[model samples]
Target: MKILITGANGQLGQEVSRLIPDASRPGRNEMDMADPGAVGRTLDEIQPDLIFNCAAMTDVDGCEKDRNSAYMINSVSPSVIAQYCIKTGARVVHFSTDYVFDGTRGMYTEEDAPDPVNYYGLSKILGDFAVIPLSNSLIIRTSGVFGEKMNFPLFVYTSLRDGKEINAIESSYSPVNAANLARASVEVERKGLSGILNIAGDRISRYEMALGIARFFGMDESLVRKGNKIPGGIARRPFDSSLDISRATKLLDWDFHSLESNISRLDVH
Candidate 1:
């Protein structure tokens, strides 16, 4: 397939790229999704038969600080990509988040209605809507993705390595392995699955995930402290954004790893 991966340098994007080594990978400077003109020109050039749109403005508080940029990248850009794919008969794999839910509950299924609590989630929810009707498209909602690219778990590992204390949030989530999610995405695409599907690791809290990272790396788990609130945070987090992957589990006949197994699988720098 003539494949294109947006945000190819990001955490999930890099993992996706590693799995699909020959896919076209444009840097942010090359195809900034925030700019419609750039996205248009890039799409025209690539004319990909498949698109893995891993790009997004993911910083929750940053999304709250700049709604325009958030909506542009998270919503408008995906709309543009979907429109392009619609005309060209290309299939797309759109990455989404568990943040679409309000977190009043846990293990949310695809049937669950999204009631986002923050601007970032709101923007991503809008993005999901834009791609919902696109034929042959797959929207995979994942959570707390960490990989070779710097992410939450890496932060904990480094903090403990430096002998600095870390405040691990108490929010519960399925901290997905980006490598696992990426590999599974390819299988899901090959299986011709459409619409929304959940792909994530076993559910656990930030504190628990922090300790798992420490255990994997043989670091001091005691350095990780638990807290419910982010100090001076801009956006409100969901209490439990863990996704229920029952559908994906049956479809792929593959379930993600447990926290311990997942961390063990990672090189986890």
Candidate 2:
């Protein structure tokens, strides 16, 4: 099947591209998501049977500072893509975040009502609503994603390597590996599944996650400090935005890796 992946240079996008090497991977220069007309034009040119929209403005604090750019990329761009897919009979697989839920509740189910506390989450929630109604779409909400690109675990690794102290939140989350998420996304599309699904790693606290990485790499765990409260930032974070992946496990018959296991697999220096 013909496939197109937007934001092919991003963390998740790169992993998805690796999984589907034959898929058309387009960078911002080829198709700027900020311009809906440009995106539509690219879609028309490719005429892909399926489109994986991995493009997103994921900088949490940055989104708080620039809400317009966040909404445009997170909400409007996906809406435009969904509209075009509707007209062209192409299927869409959009990635979403666990931030859609308020931190007061952890282990969020697909049926749970979303109450985003930050602008980033609000933008993603809006994007989710826009695409959810489409008959040919799969909105996969994942959490604390890590990949070859710089992420939470990588930040910890680099900091420790430089002999600098790191402060990790005690907040809990289900950190999914980008490679695993990419694999599951393809499986969902191949199985002709539709609607929302939660694909993430086992639930664990941020501090524990960092500490585990330090321990695995034989680094000084003491350097990884446990933060009691959410660090001061432009955005508010969910303390327990961990998602329940029971549906994904049952439907895909796939087992998600634990935080340590996923970290151990990383080839970062």
Candidate 3:
């Protein structure tokens, strides 16, 4: 099947590209989702059977600074793309976030109501809402995703290599790893499963993840200090964003790897 992958350079996009044998990767130059006309033109030209849309304005802080850009990329663009997919009879695999939940509950289910606390989360939730009603779309909500092209893993690697102290949140929590999330998305598309699924890793806090990585590198875990969220920050993250993947297990019939396994699989540079 002819497949189209948006955000071909992103963490999840790259992984999804690798997962597909020969995906049609559309870079920003070819089809910038931020540009409405460009998205339509690309959809018309490619006419792909499956479209894996991994592009987004993911910088939570940056999104706060540019809410218009975030909304355009996260919600408006995807909704427009979904409308095009509906016309083209293309199945869509849309990447989303666990931030859709407000975090009052520790483990979220697929049926949970979305109450995003920030502009970034709110935009993603809008995209999720837009896609669910049309076309064969699979919405995968994940959190703290780390990968070769990710910022989080790079921060961890740089801090250790530079011998600088690192700080992580002991209170906040979620599962993470871009490659694992991408793999799950590929499997969902390959299986033609359509619904909301949580592509999360073994749940743990940022502090625990740091300690685990430090341990992996034989570094001093003490260098990784636990920190709390800044008071009155623009984004209000859920203290615990762990998602229950029982539905994913039942529907996808594939077991997700543990956080330790995810770290072990990383290149770590």
Model 2, 28-50: lDDT tens per residue?
88788777778888888888989
TM-score of 1: 0.93
Per-model TM values vs. the true structure: 0.93, 0.95, 0.92
**Which ranges in model 2 have alpha carbons more than 4 Å from their true place?**
none
lDDT of 2: 0.88
Global CA lDDT computed for model 1: 0.88
Residue by residue across 165-243, what tens digits does model 1's lDDT show?
9998878898877888898888998898999999888889888888888877888888988876756778998999998
The total of clashing pairs for model 1 equals 0
C-alpha RMSD for every candidate: 1.7, 1.5, 2.0
TM-score, structure 3 vs. true = 0.92
Which pairs of residues have clashing backbones in candidate 3? none
Q: Which 10-residue window in model 1 sums to the lowest lDDT?
A: 260-269
